[model samples]
Target: MDTLCSRMLLFLGLAPFMTLAATPPPTHQFTLDNGLQVLIREDHRAPLVTSHLWFKVGSADEAPGQTGLSHVLEHMLYKGSGKTCADEASRILESIGAEENAFTTQDVTGYHQTLAPRYLGVVFELMADLMSTARLHADDLAREIAVIREERILRTDDNVDAAALEHFTALAHFANSYRTPTIGWMHDLQRVDAGELRHWYESRYAPGNAVLVIVGDVTLAQVQPLAERYFGVLQKRPVPRLLRPVELQLPGERHLTLHRDVATPQLLMAFNLPGLATAKDPHTVHALRLLNALLGGADSARLPKKLELTERVLNHVETRYDERTRGDSLLLLSAELTDPPQADLDEVQARIWQEIEALRSTPPSLDELERARTRLIAQQVYARDSIAKQARELATFQTIGLPWRLLDEDARALAKVTPQDIREAASTWLTRERLSVVHVQKGGGR
Candidate 1:
């Protein structure tokens, strides 16, 4: 979320968006005549509002050779629309003293602006204008392609850690477009023309396929009129919801080792697990949450204790899992090697598997499991302290095909997870046969 990453924030692949909290967010929902759905929450805390537009299309929807079109389209929408000169959108928002940004995920693409409550109309009109009339000029598309291509190179080609993660994720999945990068393949991006972008936009950026989320010091009555006036008349059509694929279980463990010129070695392990909204068993979702917090969600977790302080083999480690993904969830454990000679890469790798084995064989103590549960709950409660976070979480859930009730539902489910439940999650979901390991080792090259 820095100067550069903020604009290109979608490329960062942040740990995960939104925390599972106990208290459900307050939201008012309505659909326009043209099928555009709108959700608004009145927060009189300050005279400010956050306006968001989420489209139900992302990387997974892309066909081969057309990857990254969604993200490229996101950039062009910001470039400008009818009667709005190039970059004029930003100038107008800046004049109003507002903040605007956007990002693309595996399941959705979103654009947002935070400004005064009085400026709500301005934001709405601009968003509608872009959605309806963005001019995908050939010159503009050419410029943006070059910019996005540079971004792909900086984030992927020269960056070993990111490259490893991308490859590992694709290999872990049996088959699908999810293996392709959201920023897109360099070859495909070079060939993506204005016509291709316009076709995707016209087909996917319809009112029926979008959701409007507004959070601020405004009532539903006051906002409804504005939404309908600005967004109502758009043509209605059925959204082409992607029929998700069922990921086949990997027959045996999949491992990949990268030998390249690098400063330090890196290790990544991912286990495909149940997603919260898509899981058949509710308990599996909750149990996996607790297990994640216990393992790599915190500083005092197992990876730090076993690999860094106790065995003293590694120094950096982080775990990530998104149970709410549109597709299968991946529980990932990643670590960077320490400098001072401790243990060779082989020994470190063996210890990593041993940690998972221990969790399956022996369930965590009541105290350990309880601590993780309590910590997770606390984090969710604190997440509400930020109005922006709550609104984004609400939009994220709704856009990804999950009901808003999931906020409280997941929290309650986590409370029922016992030590045995955690052990079951490890044994059932964290299978050795499905595990995928990738290592980036040092080699003599650029």
Candidate 2:
């Protein structure tokens, strides 16, 4: 009934989405002699276009001392670059009615813009300048660091949920660069100077370490020349592959109870899992995606159905399993508790583990498995409706060592996920030893 209602909502204009076929669009992919890869997809549906520049460098690449350098450089690019200061960059784009922003993730830092198709050359020039001539001015670095520190206060220090996630992930991985937050520690940011920023930038921002994604209102015939003219001039140097520390094993179950001033308590559990880039079994990833959908949403979801129908202490349950990473990642399940809880937390944990063990032992019924795959397919269709998101998706795949065609392959692969695969994946990857649990406490209580 709920699934039917959701489809009804989709038909009633409450949901807008897209599902590109496995074939994808007619994208022209090529590389420059300077080592930059470019993907161009033409969409003449609108007069708008989005240009994305993805640097294949992120927090994972940062050494112990240079945490958040990728994010810091993202801010510095906006503070100003080359001769086009932030003001000038803003003025230039604003004059042409452009929307622009940049973000850093675990495996990639990307800058993007959506603007009139005619402004493609303009963006190319702006990005090319930043790529080569970023000033990393001392005053600018200090000011931005202050801005980021305040951001930290709001996002991590004051927000207990965010703080808990930080500590949870740190303890979860224990020994990899993934343990560090993308937003570097306040102390590290305080000490990072222009020279340090410049060094990180120059080393990672080379043409060899980048992918340019263009979609909408343009073709490669029109974009290739401008790309060459603006970006081709940059020097070609082999991108230094950073040493990636492998997690040989989880030492044991790790747990943290964070006490802070808050209105309610929350519980989070995560398991270390292989990423799409590094996974030995691709089928497990597809099965995991279906498994997350089946276990996360709707009244029928495993977490909610068991806990909620029984009227346990949980106010809500959410499970997220994103396999997009350059290395190991996680399958995370989190829940918010009803205040002044009536249920025993240990009992709740036991029940949750039981559901996991069931998945490992019994293959889900065919109907349930099909429902999970259907929801997964429908959501993907809805997620790629925006030209900007499409371009971003393209760049992200390349950055994470995933082929662009994987986007199309996903729908096809998801359909092939069998119940047996889910059982095996749950049993193999979601073991007790790989799990880390975090409890958020509102006050001074165990």
Candidate 3:
């Protein structure tokens, strides 16, 4: 076991976060009078604390033509509030040698900060003001919109792989909101105004709809009072779930071919799978997670070993599956063509399917499954080293309508996932009907 830990630390570059045998700190949960949810994890290793305030509204919650409103609002929140003006909140945190940032995703918008434990009250006061009494100044919104436009161009428009993935996501889901990009459409960004952002913020960012997660150098007793003093006074409002159309299980595979100016071709294969929120059979989510790891979670996984090392057809390959979502999740396999180009995309696709077939037809050895489990468990353990990451994990689970306790149970579930579970998951979920194949070919002027 010690040898495996050493190897994983070196192989994964996780040595800095590795405290090989230490257990995670206990996490406590509470709800305020105004319906604000609070989660506190006591980590006394350092005198620093990380706090995450997550709202259950994101790009998926936006109506058509108002996409990216959530992200724009995230940026504008930094511009000012009643107590802080024009980046004053950031300046305050920076003055205290703290780090702060926020992100907008498909299902949530999170604002986070890491600072000395004594500054916990300061962060809470600033964030509470931003949440309830934010000054969505029109000028600030205009400037932030411009910044976001450039962000969209740099991140998606000019970047070939990102553009291809955007197109692929659109083609893959019919009624699911995941089809919408988090950055939103370029035209929508042009039309979104301050009034729209204010309405979006008021309608979504409420005490009832937010979760506050704190980790590191803090006790529940210390945090509960600060949380109540700053945030508990806010009035709770009704934040209804946005009604989105259900994704129909349509027959036939979806394929997209994009032409871009690129040095090497790329292939992306994504299958729509059930997430923690959508899965009817609970164990399916864990099984799919393990299957993803076994396929491409590491350099030693099947895809890298065969395609990159043995077949020499691809230079890079990776698989991604996130079960913590309010909607259906995507299990993605992405690869890049080798330099000098080995095989055409057609042959590469065939070889990829052959590997999937191998897992579907025959189960893996117990040793193979155990290795994948160990890799996943080790990654989870390493994540605990960072208070920010720890808080985010708790917030994500709670915001997605699951208990944070699921974090501890995940390893046990993964351990119970047998070889038969792997075969069944691959055979059931990795099907043509569920698959979306996207090819980014070398070309220009598309």
Candidate 4:
């Protein structure tokens, strides 16, 4: 994740005077009678268009026993639809020289296609068909469940680092639905039947609960009618009330340790924080975003600079935070031990606390602050170079109940994030009550 930021920082430092595009291609928005939202941006840079169909529901919307139902439904969509056989949609896309894929996250699930302008309507037709009349056969459900279980095994169960993160996240939140992994737990996958899947599809996969974003060499005139002819015709239905449980306040830091079969030792520290949509003070959100970059989002950040490079206390370190989420988010720091440890998690953690205390006590230098901001700006500028990223950014804002214009406000808001603001944010949010720590080492059971 830091690779792109590192490269951008290097380029910016060496170039001395490099400029990105001043303005992005104009974006247009409209809503259908059936309540489906559509946003289109015309980028004639290439004869290709990227379309993303996004549903606002994800793992966070699922009930306790029905964890991963949203992700499983995403899989079943590719299995078959009213007009296409199992995997036929993928085959059709391949035949048309198009690239297509789908993903499920904590707050959104999206299916996307990048194809020649001539194939725009065909892709929309496929997505609309899947939305309205996906064939959730019993046999397909059983098979896909097995596939999902295998996927969990590979992504979470077999990987020690990922498993540690999973356990940490679960312990971080008690009532918040985010405690559950997006791929879901192994036991939850075993009991999901076709009926439950069909119910989830019918309830959550409605036009009212979705957003369609198209970017590239396509005009609103060309895309709008295609959207109407396919997606507009689908009947809108009531979606389940998104009951995102608030995490009750905890007294102090929550800690856990897991011993797994791994050579490298791992450490994770997370501070529960409000995301963009949930924050009462938007400035704090932007400040935290900048603080993340200063701490670990970049190679030149404090964590890697002080610990990994200078002190040799750790070999790697990075921070993870997502402000686009619908509910609370985590400011996470993950690190691994050096080859022959002169320091353990206790020593590394103490050093980390010292750095945090430094930030809380004193503001960063103006030059250091500017570098972090520039890196974030470069990331946004690079993201706009891809149509898929542009579409996703638009859809994500819409899904999270924010206007796309908020993206335009980002640079201005981020620029206003003074050093004092960063220090204040760190002091206010990174508290012991909001913290969770996980330690992983080589061995058997905890």
**For residue 87, what is the lDDT in candidate 4?**
94
Q: Residue 387 in model 2: shift from native, Å?
A: 1.0
Write down the RMSD of candidate 2 (Cα, Å). 3.8
lDDT of each residue in 325-411, candidate 3, tens digit only: 888888888999997898988889999999999998899876677778778878888787889888988999988888988886766
Q: What is each predicted model's overall lDDT from 0 to 1?
A: 0.80, 0.80, 0.86, 0.86
lDDT of 1 by residue, 370-396 (tens): 667767766777766666776787788
CA lDDT of 357 in candidate 4?
85
Top-down lDDT ranking: 3, 4, 2, 1
Cα TM-score per model: 0.92, 0.92, 0.94, 0.94
**Structure candidate 2, residue pairs in collision:** 17-382, 18-381
Report RMSD (Å) for each prediction in the order shown. 7.8, 3.8, 3.8, 4.2
Report the C-alpha lDDT of model 4 over 260-308, residue by residue, as the tens digit: 8867788999988888888888989999999999989988999999999
Residue lDDT tens for model 2, 87-161: 688678888999988888878889888999888899999889988987878988888899999998899887777
**TM value for model 4:** 0.94
In angstroms, give how far residue 232 of model 3 lies from its true place: 0.8
- Candidate 4: C-alpha lDDT: 0.86
Q: Deviation in angstroms for 356 in model 3?
A: 0.6
